[model samples]
Target: MVDQWKAPSAAEPAVGDDKSWKLLEKTLLAGVQEQRRARRWGIFFKVLTFCYLITVLVLFTPLLDMERTAVSGSGYTALIDVRGVIADKEEASADNLVTSLQAAFEDPKVKGVVLRINSPGGSPVQSGYVYDEIRRLRGLHPDTKVYAVISDLGASGAYYIASAADEIYADKASLVGSIGVTAAGFGFVGAMDKLGIQRRAYTSGEHKAFLDPFEPEKPDETKFWQGVLNVTHEQFIASVKQGRGDRLKDKEHPELFSGLVWTGQQALPLGLIDGLGNASSVARDVIGAKELVDFTVQESTFDRFSKKLGASVAQQLAMWMGFQGPTLR
Candidate 1:
């Protein structure tokens, strides 16, 4: 009777229940902390790997350039490439070309300079800048002759640059010459009208938004824009004539500056190209230097990557918005 019945107190938990709960909570907490630690380590390792790669790239690029310079040796033909659109930030830009030309001319080891061009052409302003620089550099270094060798295609602004060379050469099948200026954009006025949309563009001046694609075509504005293109075309033609110095057969072919492209063979008879040859042929036979050394100004890998990541988006946006200037194409 004494071993029998004293009721359990309500304040007390069941035997082992409290201890089991405490153990479970501790296990959960430890697991969460461990997971967090692993995540932090993963991030750290990823950052470390990225830094290592960048360091290796930065350290080795200069060494590669030095090796190229050593291989160039004492005397060689300096080759500057003009490949792609001749725009402000492009590979064939005025700044890059001028810098390359300067480096080539300043070097006593450079017997001659060759501009290897393969472009469909781009900005007239950039081309003009390069043309002016080439002339100035030629005056400064009369011994180092600058020759342009057109590869696959050299038209419009590209031809403009080539004309500045002492003598222009091209492959017999190469496309050359397109001495013209054009400003092109899409007209969204009709499309907007069809879609029952009204364009409301505010501007300080009346003709300020004349070239706006969302606006209706005004006859007066059209005439004014044509006049602007005509003026730019005239300037381009004048530069070519000045550079070629009577080599152009404009008298026989009035359509020479009508934006028509010609093959290298056709260009020779028409006085567009002086000779038919490639970069190697010109280097060996013309410059008398069989060993050709590249003097093209190349952007570093990091610079290229950064630009593509940043500026390319903005450039595409500007183009899509129809805000374009005169192009020599």
Candidate 2:
């Protein structure tokens, strides 16, 4: 123990002698070099991130168009894609569609506009906005014809949008129209009764919990709700009739507007579609423009980034609740 504490002789090497000092110096130098290298990488990533964000901003802004329009060839048909469910926060949202449509119409080189629709349809309100915008734009630009060319499926609200167009075209096998409105959900009151589970709910207003699934359905409330749906359906029918005008032989085919869908080939006689043609055919033959320019406004990178963060948190919660997550039909 004493030897352990004892001071070394003059000839004996110090615990931290020149050799150890050299090793220590080397370790410190290596650490500093590593830190400098890490900082350089950090700076590089930061610059890369900045550039990427700038590019995204430019894509969403008018700057990209301003730069490209000078070289963009003339008389190309501006194509705006209206895919997926037309609802709030969706890719086919009214806001996004309207913006894209306006951009397509505003382009001087664009001879006409093609609304390429392939949607199962959703949100009558969102679809209504799009329908109105198309009418408004058509009034503004009488010469620039707008056409809706359906692919795969364009039903319900998607059909609503197509009705407002100058003409609608689709493939022979394309599912064209489902002219109706519906609001549906499951009722858990009977299930709760069988399970002997009590469900509690509170509301300040009587109609606040009007359609609460946990409570028994009220006949008067049900009647009122059905009336609402009926009114919306009536509006849909009126829009279709008004758009189609003399072309629609609705009296002969009364079932056409009764929430039943029809193929593009079958729809021509009902006047739901003008002809059996795809986007390419419409652009080539109808619009007399071969070149197609896509004006669809894609979601921004930042929008996707934020949505991913939200989805991550929601998915974690869903997992805890024993939900496997949603799958498309």
Candidate 3:
């Protein structure tokens, strides 16, 4: 057998020579290496996927309607927390408030609804929608009482919504009133001149560019803008008067419509707020229920992360593009 298995000729190359064994070993080693690399990547990706799922679960789970403990007994108080600016886009939106209100009214166990408001107000239209919804819900469910409990600051449109409630309560230090409207714009005529940049703007109508800040503000234009502001202010005042009615001491206090915000303590005397209290106290003492369920739709993790990521990417891109904001700090 040894004599028959002679080494192949040089021209034929190594069929089963030392080189052949070496080549086969190299190929096998390469295959093993490839498999190891693939397995490492697979493990890494699996771990990454697991981590991502865990993070999303932890972050988003809080926003969903957490399962409630079974209420064996009778009456319940549904707590509706309305925090931050009352804008349509925000968590404390008109839609969110309406949904919470509807839930409270629909729940048979929920005896009353307590609106826990902690906001500085937002768009007039948004606040108006919320106010109207609250009134409508109350009318539809007459038995269920609705109370507005203010915390921190609830002014302007916030106060407007609160006025629709049966009773308004607040902490003494809370800012309670700002019955007014305002529009502000920067006059950049001087800045433009300094920068040697002219804002060449054209309009079809004479008053179309009435409040153009890049150009000099004409005396007539200023007067026109003032008139617009006055009209909006009048509307706000009218709403307040209508909402409060006999309770408003507009005639007795000349400064009622002066856009002066007052503390909850000062507000009580001025008839801006009913009394001083928080949401918990109102839920327990006033509503006569201990169990409170928060009906506010908390911000979802995906939304929060997306916003943060978008902002971060935007900031990085802006920095790379050499763009600076008004306050660099």
Candidate 4:
């Protein structure tokens, strides 16, 4: 027993101890190999998923096959959609519409351009800009005709832009015109008095707070604003007259420009619309283009998502910027 207590030999260890060390080393090596294999597979699947997503996105967007969809040797008709409120920074803004119109007209394969409108109305200034640009573009490309085709409704500022087109078409039951100008705001003075609330505001100019909702109504301000609306309405009537010329039956309809909306059937006699036809039939029979190429500027998916996420923030920003006026709705 005393001899067995001596230290193990340095040259050679016991059989059992040597075997245990060899097994431990082998297990660790196998574990490292398995981990490496798992990591490689994970990286491969991630790259494959990324590639699949990219391919799907490309197929979904128009940019994928623009040449095939837009133009061919037979020629095509360009369609620019004017939908929703025609505000400065909105989807139907003058900048986007005008840009789309220019591109459509400039394309040689496009024999004609169509302004497809479906809107209530919006800012007069934005509509004016789009109207003027369309006129200018027509002058530049005299050979390429521009037609406005109203869907269910095209009124107010929408009609302003449509008037500039070479011809305006609409469905028989469509609401064609609302040529007018208006500005609307509320007066909260009476409500505040009933609630026993006091309003405080400071402005540099005496009339700067003239349109404040919480302040008492001012007779002079109301008169002044009514006059402003009348002036703008007059401008709208003048533009329509200039655009329509002899086609308009002004004698028969005295209230044609009095913010009166008319059906497409009534609009024909009023010279508010030229004919009744949908975009497809007009493209096929009128323009002689079976293939229709839409030239509308669509907002990106990310941009729409961001707008939804920041809606409250946008409202706050708009509130800070006061007195947005000259609206044609």
Best by TM-score: 1
State TM-scores per candidate.
Answer: 0.84, 0.76, 0.76, 0.76
lDDT tens string, model 1, 68-120? 47746668898989999999978888888888888889888888899999999
Residue 133 deviation, candidate 1, in Å?
Answer: 0.2
- Deviation of model 2 at 98, angstroms: 1.4
Off by over 4 Å in 1: 1-11, 47-51, 301-329
- TM for candidate 2 is 0.76
lDDT of 3 by residue, 183-251 (tens): 888999888889999899988998898888887889998998888879877877877777777887778
Off by more than 4 A, model 4: 1-51, 58-63, 67-70, 301-329
Model 2 backbone overlap count: 0
Candidate 2, residues 1-329, lDDT tens digits: the string is: 35557788999988769888899999999999999999999999968865765575567556534533643756788888899999998889998899888887788888889999999999999999999999999999999999999999999999999989999999989997788888899999888989999988878988899999899899999999999999999999898887778888799988888889888889898888899888888999999987887788765434443355488764553444343421111
Separately for all candidates shown, the number of backbone clashes (residues 3 or more apart, or on different chains) is 0, 0, 0, 0
Which portions of model 2 show Cα errors greater than 4 Å? 1-73, 300-329
lDDT of each: 0.86, 0.84, 0.79, 0.83
Q: Tell me how candidate 1 scores on lDDT.
A: 0.86
Give the CA lDDT, 0 to 100, for residue 183 in model 3. Answer: 82
Q: How many pairs of residues in model 1 come into backbone collision?
A: 0
lDDT of 2: 0.84
Candidate 4, 1-329: lDDT as tens digits: 35565666888787598789989999999999999999999999968855664564466644534544536767999988999999988879998898899888878889898899999979999999998998899999998988999998999999999999899999989998888888888888889999999998989987998878998878999899899999988888888888888898877887888888999998998899899998888898889986888778865532333356387753453344341222210
RMSD of each: 6.7, 8.1, 9.2, 9.5
Best by lDDT: 1
